[model samples]
Target: MKKNKTLSEMTEEELVGEFTNASIAQKEASEKDKFSKYNKLFDRIVEIRNERKIRPGDRRRDLLPLLTHDNIQVRLMAAIETLAVAPDAACRTLKEIKDSNWFPFAMDASSTLSWFESGRFRPE
Candidate 1:
């Protein structure tokens, strides 16, 4: 039989330490599972995308393609994530889509970009 551990039984540092020796692939798979499991718990993907530990250049490249994802929420998250790293690089793409006929979806992206530029919302 497996012994269950309470959340309080493990400190954050202890939890991190347990995974410290994991291979990169193992760590990524775990993170993906966690992200999918808690996707609705706020913008977790965006948070991951903004993590300093992620290679900024690689993230920037990945985010560009996500901007065109079929899911509007994914696209919005990509826009936010891209802006967090390279606001100027994302500005042109965002401006092109801001006036799209997608109603509130496009509007929301535009609003988020505006807020980011005005410093109303700081990423990380």
Candidate 2:
């Protein structure tokens, strides 16, 4: 029997690769199963919330806490992904962060949320 690699043992690239592969595989398997798979992956993200090493967009809800991550890249990506999924909910959070020191990221989130709310980006 082969031992599975723990997420902690994987490099950032490896973790992203695994997530991408899982996403693709789940998408191809069955439309009805997609949500379950996505939820499972999301659960995995929740399990590692404190690990401080998750890939961007791993968990939609993770964006809330990441709005204040020390790394701008992480914060920006989280804001973008959160807006993409829930523009309305992101609006308030974005507003709260807009005047903070991380103005650039807050602006990105606010703009994206506005665009979505404006019907410029319709769901497919």
Candidate 3:
């Protein structure tokens, strides 16, 4: 009979959990070419980011540990999101992913790095 907490009321750990789940769902949706679902999940992840960013200490760096997650997509998303907080670690992870020759994700990592380098994508 416990009431469910809204995302805004969740703790930092809860927000990270939500971000992880949303990232996984987004990856699955993308694989199925479900653009609508994927986009929704993407927005949710961004909302989580915004929520964390405005917190007293800016806990977005809490995602840094996920940079080594078993799921490549999760790791990729974490690296991309944490770029502004930990640029060196994030770039190293992206390079590792790209160099691993893992299709789709490797390509994504490479493209993300290129975008960062060219100032087309700025991690907030």
Q: lDDT scores for all predictions? A: 0.52, 0.53, 0.90
User: Quick one: RMSD of model 2?
Assistant: 12.2
Number of the candidate with higher TM-score, 1 or 3:
3
Residue clash pairs of candidate 3: none
lDDT of 3 by residue, 6-119 (tens): 777999889889889998987888789899998899889888888887889859789999998888889999999998999999999999999999977899999999999899
Give the Å shift of residue 39 in candidate 1: 7.8
lDDT of 1 at 40: 35
Model 2 global lDDT (CA atoms, 0 to 1): 0.53
| Clash statistics: count for each candidate | 0, 0, 0
Better of 2 and 3 by lDDT: 3
Candidate 1 accuracy as lDDT: 0.52
Per-residue error at 40 for model 3, in Å? 0.8
Candidate 2 structure quality by residue, lDDT tens digits, 1-124: 5378777766555554454444344334334556677567555543444333354544455455655555543444445456656665555555655555465455665676667678885532
Q: TM-scores, in order shown?
A: 0.49, 0.38, 0.90
Which parts of model 2 are misplaced by more than 4 Å?
1-59, 62-64, 84-89, 101-103, 122-124
